[model samples]
Target chain A: MIEIKDLQKNFGDTKALKGVNLTVPDGELFAYLGPNGAGKSTTIRILTGLTKISKGRARLGGYDIEKEPRAAKRQFGVVHQHVNLDPELTVFENLDIHGQLFGMSKAARRARIKELLDYIELTGRAATLIKQLSGGLKRRVTIARALLHEPGIIFLDEPTVGLDAAIRRRIWALIKKIQLRGTTVFLTTHYIEEAEFLADRVAFLDKGRIIALDTPANLMAMAGAWAIDQFKDSGMQTHYFKDRKQAAAFQTDDSFTLRRVNLEDAFLSLTGKKVQP
Target chain B: MINECLAIYRREMLILKRRLIRQMAGQAVSPLLYLVTFGYAMGDKIRFDGISYLDFLLPGLVAMSSMTRSFAIATDINVARFYWHIFDEFQAAPISNVSYVAGEVLAGMTRALMGIIIILGLGLLFGVHLAYGPMFWLPILLNSFLFASLAVALAMLVKNHADQSLLVNFVITPMAFLGGTFFPIARLPGWLQSILKLLPLTHASKAIRQAALGKPVNLHSLALLAALGAVIFLIALGCVNRARD
Candidate 1:
């Protein structure tokens, strides 16, 4: 549903995206993982037509983002990394305006707004102003607004960045439900567990380049099944082992903790840096 | 594009609806104070162009109100861009740059018209009647368009609320005072008159006052305003395009 070919973006002397290429097939839940300033948002911005691409081509649902921006934009819904809803507008009004922008008829907008409010479990708060809502509720309303137009694809850029763990899981379930409904989902995040738990396939983006791309299980397996983490003068240093027995055999006088290898370990093994900076 | 523009315009109208009472009160209070303080004090004392001072000031007040209210959209734009981040939502949507600019400019114009109506009503309350004709609205709209377009362009360039206020203090406030709004431009020296004549609001005041006093409408002023509006609107479009990049 989304195709990016040799995409490059530059801001003067700094390159935000360096010849990155990616393709997310229909109904796939793909996560673009990276640290701060790692080009995850830049890639999403290019795909959503929010920012211009310096080179190469990006297509959304077969429409070129540069040459056919309107049509391309019509094919996808974008939930930006930052909250962008009109604070003075009611929840329903926010969704209503979005539907209208996409040219939905009055009856259609009403029906969609009702359906989305219900879907996001915010029907009771439909008439409430966005500023009155809590952070998690605001995030849900933003998600609902993005889905109002019923686009074929959705780009969620750090959708649950600052939310608490419980709220984050709720959003994760919502995202999974969206994928189950047959919409192609493209998510970007620095949270390793979010990508592991929600994404079908994950791509590691470091310094504007895709360093690793694979399924969570495959990526973890390549890094090893078990990890021994020991606190050092520098920081927490983790050593990977093929199995529990191997990890058990490797011992040190310093205190250590044994845990399962996660996406973070895979990223650290690939790029030698933590995902959170 | 038209539909998208209307959608944005409708959203602004909705916000305006919620704040209608406060907005009208704010709009009404300023002109009323001007009419009471200036109109009553100078009604019998001063005369210009063979009319009462109160009569001469009505059209100028109307012209000034329209300019100030229309240009007030810069504050709204800045709030949306900075505080609310609502511009990003529009950016990611399927709307065209032209549609966004058209919608905002129209919203500003609507605010200007609303201000004009309030001021006109105040004039009626004070027993100051002027000609209400088609010529009156033409220059009013042209003036609103000119300032609204300029507001959009400047809104894009301002970095924050401080910068926006700086723009008002340095650019809009001076124009409001000196743009033939409160007095006749002919009273100024020749050089200052030439410079003030270059302002769109000056032409707007000239045309509106002429129409109000039963003088023949100055097509030259209307034409000048229309030309300035068109040029500034194109500049606003360019600013919108550049801002997205």
Candidate 2:
């Protein structure tokens, strides 16, 4: 479980986060959605003990992040938004070192690393240097490295940011597989479909505060079930209706295209802005 | 705490092991050049305090290499920080700041020891034998410890690779020559010697040479080196702690 209360972050005169509060239950795949500069990374950094918390309290698996940093850190593994693995080290060595840092025994580290290699489908590539791996392969190894110590929760900051759709789906499967094994997952991503598809619950964060939080279906339902996008001289305007019949009736010209409302549409309706813009 | 430190040290040693030959060869080139040019060219004509120039120059080289080799850990730290992002992994791990500093310092000292051994072996091949006991090695260990701690502190403070290189040029390079490696500090004017004595390496060279020459060990220099090493190691711990935030 993860608990956060009145989280606030300030950078000089700039207020990056403003009294954000959230809680994630165990075994929940929670996706935090936000645009750029929304204090997403800052929140992750604070929770992971990489940055100091300016205000409020946070706990990971009952361990207070500030007062008990090492315990809090041990409770959760983090896959950073960037690839932070050692390029000079082979996959096995990278995982081995992480296990060592956690104070795992030599025999335990070997067994766990081998199991994680198989888990991430990189079993045969253990000897390959991180620099020699493809971007997708590197991301897989990064995930494997994070899971080496078997923490209760994992924080993944944009795990599939630049991968293709097919690769993203494969990663989503891996994430879902991990979650099914009972690890609470805190995910942040710009991919609305990803949040919609994989998240047990989604939180839409804008300018540091979460504007909405609920199950993906419930959040999307806030914008109605149907949407009709009409392109005009001014700009594109979206009209939402409770039913497909209402949406079809609302569209009168070739400029209008009717479709089901998506998580992005729900976010746009709530915040009047794009999630990625 | 010991386990975490060993983990960090093990990573550095693994990397060093992979490039062991390259590092060995790189370390050998400079001392060999010094031995051939300075030790061989001067031969028996230049004796400092009734000792052959090779004997005098050999211990000096040992002291100098210990300083340089340990200080060289800063470059590896910079590479890990700027390019590999390995430090980020460390930051996110469960390791404490003191453990991280201790581990890196140990690795730096290990590298210094390797360079010292290589110089000693070259000294044998050149037929120059000096004292090789605790009296000789204790100062070398202290010198390595002081410089390695300084390296870790500076590595944390440097912003980029260029800044790190500038530090080497302005700080390490000047100290290398002025700290009595090639010549005795007493050869300089009294006022200049006073300023040179302020350098940690000067004390290191003096004590190491005294011990290697089988002269009575300078307890004062050894005490200063130990004190300086402890202070710098504490500073390194503080720097690592600050960097973590």
Which model scores highest in TM-score? Answer: 1
* Reference-based lDDT, residue B154, model 1: 93
Best by DockQ: 1
A83: Cα error in model 1, Å = 1.7
| lDDT of each residue in B146-228, candidate 1, tens digit only | 99999999998877889999989998889889999888989999999999988888999999999998889989999899998
Q: Can you write out model 2's per-residue Cα lDDT over A186-211, one digit (the tens) per residue?
A: 99999998999999999999988999
Return the lDDT, model 2, position A144.
87
Per-residue lDDT for B1-245 in model 2, tens only?
A: 99999999999998998889999999999999999999998766798877788988888899999999999999999899888778878888888898999999999999999999999999999998888889899999999999999999999988789999999999998998888898888888999999999998998888888888889888989999999999999999888866654
Scored by lDDT, model 1 comes in at 0.91
- Cα error, residue B16 of model 1, in Å, equals 0.7
- Report the C-alpha displacement of residue A133, candidate 2, in angstroms: 1.7
